[model samples]
Target: MSVDPEDIEPTYRWPVPPAGGWTADDLDRLPNLPPHTELIDGMLAFVSPQTMFHSRAIDFFTWHLHSLAPQGLEVVREFTIDIDCHNRPEPDVLVVDEAAILGMEQTRFPAESVLLAIEVVSPDSVARDRSLKPAKYAGAGIPHFWRVENADGRAVVYVYELDPATRGYGAAGIFHARLKVDVPFPIDLDLNEITAKRRRAE
Candidate 1:
């Protein structure tokens, strides 16, 4: 049963696993899983299983982003990003500072080092990703976020920066894929191309 969105209690929510409680080893042993899983502030949240369309979009973005090679950026998939005091989420696509990944075979991203975090919103993830997760991302001091809503041909790209009072993100602007704008990866993303791809998929 779906909880009444309005009546759900705050405590009943999920975030990554707790400090001194969950380790990288524990995250690694998650069952032979299909959909990726991550612990955020001690809460176990299951990432949405990918559909073919989702996979295509992911592949396209990862390819393009990685092509910007040696730009001092790292593209990670389904990895835990320590956001802040209250949140640690594994975004579908995470772009972290290359300096942060050095000198280690494996390491957890310190909350502050993330340059961009992306989420592909599925039916189950819409509310949390739209409402709750953004707040958590902002609180952690991460500089940028992009959420892709796949219900339609276009995606809602929420470009945000920190809000000091609420300790959350305030949307800088909302751009749809059909529109023209430079996506803040410090690069130009042709949203029209994304829309065209979506159309081809349909």
Candidate 2:
């Protein structure tokens, strides 16, 4: 029988250790993370809880990104990337440079030359994406980051530009319906379509 997406269990959320710490071995040694858990900054962040809005946003963004088919770029969904020996984050959406993809063996995007990384905020992941993951992504020199917030049957998309000095995302802007970005490539994203699909009753 096919597993129901809504029936899935969520993972645990805990405080992250200090920076410049925790090797890949340390991460691998932990009990196998449930499909919903994402590793961020050497800590486990629970995700994929009961949130249709969040899931819809991710689906919509990926659809729009894939339609672009912009040369020299690739859009990946839920793929783990080894940002460093200590950090491997599976961002919701990734737009990576073609060169970065050429070196990968399978289903991985290199941290470097990642033009944009996007995360859809969940009750369990807001802190990690807004605070922890951005620092790690920026430190690895990722140029841009996007955050999606679903509230009150509406969705908001936030844009963040990476600052190497701070190694964090600087909030650039927010969009309610449509979001456009020149980086990674030139294309427009229609968030309204995604949100509308989510709001439609089952």
Candidate 3:
């Protein structure tokens, strides 16, 4: 009585990009693009399926950040940053100025409004997360960056702080067991239990 989904011919088509390629604003107008679709160097980069490791690490870091962020800052997860006309990359988590939240419908944050950006490495996103995204975030002058990697079933965080002279991030620390930071507000986290379910004390 009902047509099976696989039996129906897909009517959707991938949009042919303009001569100059897709701009950041095109991301808003594109049809059927998957969530967290990125525009880098005027090209579209689709987000790959997430793993448990990736999702949990995001939850862990974002949870800690939301709890500790300063009064005038807000923590957001899985939102894109409108870095420029050609780049709108989404970090796993970000801390932004409270004023930058224009409304409930706003989808992207201005780069200058962001205080910190964090990315969690996935198998499919290794290059972008490790190299491309960080460079872009730094060039935009965001003050802080962190990259989380899965290592032997645990989370390892690489921290960086931007240098006003070079406009690139300088290594802050690499935390495997515990994470402690001063900039972007103080945060201390235990890495060993990052993926474990939090159980409230009785």
Candidate 1 residue-wise lDDT, 74-117, digit = tens: 88766667654335577777788887886656646876778777
* Whole-model lDDT values for every prediction: 0.65, 0.74, 0.91
lDDT at residue 151 of model 3 (Cα atoms): 87
Off by over 4 Å in 1: 1-25, 29-35, 68-70, 84-87, 103-107, 164-166, 178-185, 195-202
Worst 10 residues of 3 by lDDT: 189-198
Model 2 weakest lDDT span, ten residues long? 21-30
Residue by residue across 1-202, what tens digits does model 2's lDDT show? 9999889998676445557655544555556556645555556655556578777777777878888857788887787777877677888888877777665556456688678888888887788878888778888888888888876777888898977677767888888877877765766876777666335578
Task: In model 3, state the lDDT of residue 110.
Answer: 96
Identify the leading candidate in terms of TM-score. 3
Clashing pairs in 3: none
TM of each candidate vs. truth: 0.71, 0.75, 0.92
Cα lDDT, model 3, residue 108: 94
Q: In lDDT terms, how accurate is model 2?
A: 0.74
List residue ranges in candidate 2 displaced over 4 A: 1-22, 25-32, 48-50, 102-107, 164-167, 197-202
Cα TM-score of candidate 2: 0.75
Lowest summed lDDT over 10 consecutive residues: which window, candidate 1? 178-187
Rank candidates by TM-score, best first.
3, 2, 1
